[model samples]
Target: MSKVVLITGGSSGIGKSIGEFLTQKGFIVYGTSRNPENYPDSQFSLLPLDVKDVKTIEKTVSTIIEKEGKIDVVINNAGAGITGPIEETPEAEIKANFETNFYGPINVIKTVLPQMRIQNSGLIINITSIAGYMGLPYRAIYSASKGALELVTEAFRMELKGFNINMTNVAPGDFATNIAAGRYHVPLNEVSPYLKPYGNTLDLMNAHVDSGSDPNMMAKAIFKIMNTKNPKVHYKVGAFMQKFSIVLKRILPDTVYEKLLMNHYKL
Candidate 1:
């Protein structure tokens, strides 16, 4: 039987690309959207699900299990992005970003694991961000949230080893996607002390997404991981430099890495 797959936040961006690619590859793919009605043209099944909401996640999982009998793979791709000076960002917004990016994915995994455990075979892929590897100016919240997920996945993988329920984190660098448009940006305050540098960094961040690699690159990377007998605990897909940045963090001293980020952002 073809493997059944479920992707959260699958209506567009990287999730949509993954869903479409898997569909073409002959997997029984189901993509979740808070508003599934918006994507009538979607190539695969688009079901209603909001990662931040447990009920919707449970319902979507049950629906998939009832229809497919087994969920062979799950991609926890539903996430929100927030950018702002750590001090200026509202507490509620920070928590909200974590809700979608961190807590949300955990909820989805918890809801589906029982079913996956029953099958005695499954794959759980968490879509993280290259930004998660380190804190970035004006994007610390997003980085922290994704980073939290990455660490948890490491622990989760070991816990699931005995059951054969594999889990991995795939961190992608900026990709040409609608994430920028959806990201919550604390308005550039005319009088705020960070107006100049934050504004510049914000513009730079958006530009990177616009010029980033095709989403299909992420799609293909994910497909390859899904096919692997033992996917690594962590994988990254992006421009060489972006992936290298992670390595730089490991080999470079803390102050040096900080300087590199400061220079890149022109802070």
Candidate 2:
């Protein structure tokens, strides 16, 4: 039987690419967006979903299950980004980022776990980031959010092992996406010292994102993990150095790894 797959935050970017790719590969793909009216119709089903809303998530999943029978794979691709100094970030902004990036995935995972456990087989893929492995300068909240999700994914993989459910945290480095347009900015006051430095840092980050390789690369990695009988716990998708950075973090000392990152960002 074809796999029934559900992907969140599929309005555009890597999530959308993954959905389109999976559809071509014959998976029964259902991708979610906050507004289904704007979702581009395709072989993949576009359903209304806002990861932050538990009811919407529950309803969307149930709707899919009622039609597709079972969800074989759940991809937590929905995310939010924030750019600014941690100190200047508003409480509401921080909460919003966590709600969408971290808690959102948890909501999806918990909602699907029972059904997956009963099926005795399923895959849960979370779209983390290279930033998750290490905290970045301006994108403090975004990095923290992804890092939290990655840790959660790791813990759940072990806990769900007995049920034959697998988890893969795909830590993508950079890809051309509209994330910058949606990223929240921490309001700065006239006396704020982080103003200029924050602007410079954000510019550098945007340049890096613009230069990022195609999102399709990440999509291919997702497909690989989905098809593999025994997939690894973590997968990094990006340029050579980006993937290497993860390895470097594991082997290099904290100070050394951080210095390397700082130098790369010209900080």
Candidate 3:
């Protein structure tokens, strides 16, 4: 029997790529977007779901279960990107980022756990970020939001272990996607102290995404994880340095690591 898979934020970018790949592999793939109508040519089903809205999430999950009878895999791929200096970033924007990146995934997981538990087996993959491993300048909120989800996944794995519902985080580095266009960027202020560094960092971030690896790479990585009988709690897919940065953080002294990051970002 083909396993049914649900991918949030499936309309485009990594989610769409993953959905298309899994569909090609014979999985019953369903992807979610706030506006499903926009994608008329998607390879798999595109359902309406807003991760920030629990009501919409509940509805989407209910619709999926009704149609498929069981959901074997769920990829929490829906997340928002926010870029701004912490001090200059509005309080509302920070909270909004968390609502979509952290609380959103948690709610989706919460809604699906009961169905998964009843089925006796399931897999939940949270799409995190390489940035989540460390605080990135001007993107502190985005880092915090994804980092919080990473930690939550750690706890969730242990909590759900006995029930056979495997949960893990897949942290990706820069991927060529429309994420740069979708991000909420705090406007560069003329007189703010962070204007120079923040603007430069934003440009660099955008350039990285423009030259980043294909999203299909993420698709292949996710497909592999799904096939594994026992997936590890954390898997990272990205450029060598991006993945290695995590290692560097672990081994380097606090100030040294900070300096490295500051130097790289030219702060």
Candidate 4:
């Protein structure tokens, strides 16, 4: 039987690539986007979905289950990024980031768990980031959001072990995607004096993103993980720097890591 997979935020970037890749592999792929009209008809089904909307998520899952009978995989790949210092970030902006990046995936997981538990077979992949493992300057809120997701991924992985629900978190570092261009930013009109110091920092981060690894590489890595009989709890993908970042986190003391990161960004 063809596996039925639902990917949130599948209109573009890594989500879109995953959807396309899986479709080629003979899986029935259904991708979610806030605006389905924006996506043309193709092998992958594009459904309307906004991760922030709980009611819509429930409805979408119910519809897919009714039509397809079962969902074999649910990839919580929908997320947003907000770049700036925590102090400079507005409360509402931070809350919005969490709603989309953290709570959105949590909502989808809760909605799908019952069906997955009953079937006794399923895979849940959360698209986290290297930021989840280590903090970077000017991305305080975004890092925190991914960090929360990382915790959720581990908690659910342990809890669902008995039920045979496979859970994996893919943490990609600096992929070349619309993420940098589409990142949510506060209007300059709303910027306060305190945020001025971090303007240069955000610019530098943006530049790095522009030169990051290709999104297709991350997509391929995801495909490989999905095919594994026993997927790892966490998978990191990117250029050498990203892999090294994980090693640094493991070997270096907090103080030393902080200094190294600060120097890298010239902070």
Please provide, for model 3 over 79-123, each residue's C-alpha lDDT reduced to its tens digit, 9 standing for 90 to 100.
999998898888999999999999999999999999999999999
TM-score of 2: 0.95
Residue 196 in model 4: lDDT: 48
Tens-digit lDDT track for model 1 on 94-200?
Answer: 99999999999999999999998899999999999999999999999999999999999999999999999999999999999999999898999999999999999
Instruction: Output the worst ten-in-a-row residue range by lDDT, candidate 1.
Output: 78-87
Clashing pairs in 2: none
What TM-score goes with each of the models?
0.99, 0.95, 0.99, 0.94
Global lDDT of model 1: 0.95
Clashes of each: 0, 0, 0, 0
TM-score, cand. 3 vs. native:
0.99
Clash list (residue pairs), candidate 1? none
| Ten residues in sequence with the least summed lDDT for candidate 4 | 188-197
Residue 30 alpha-carbon offset, candidate 4, angstroms: 0.3
Per-candidate local distance difference test: 0.95, 0.89, 0.95, 0.87
Give the clashing residue pairs of candidate 3, or none. Answer: none
What is candidate 1's CA lDDT for residue 37? 98
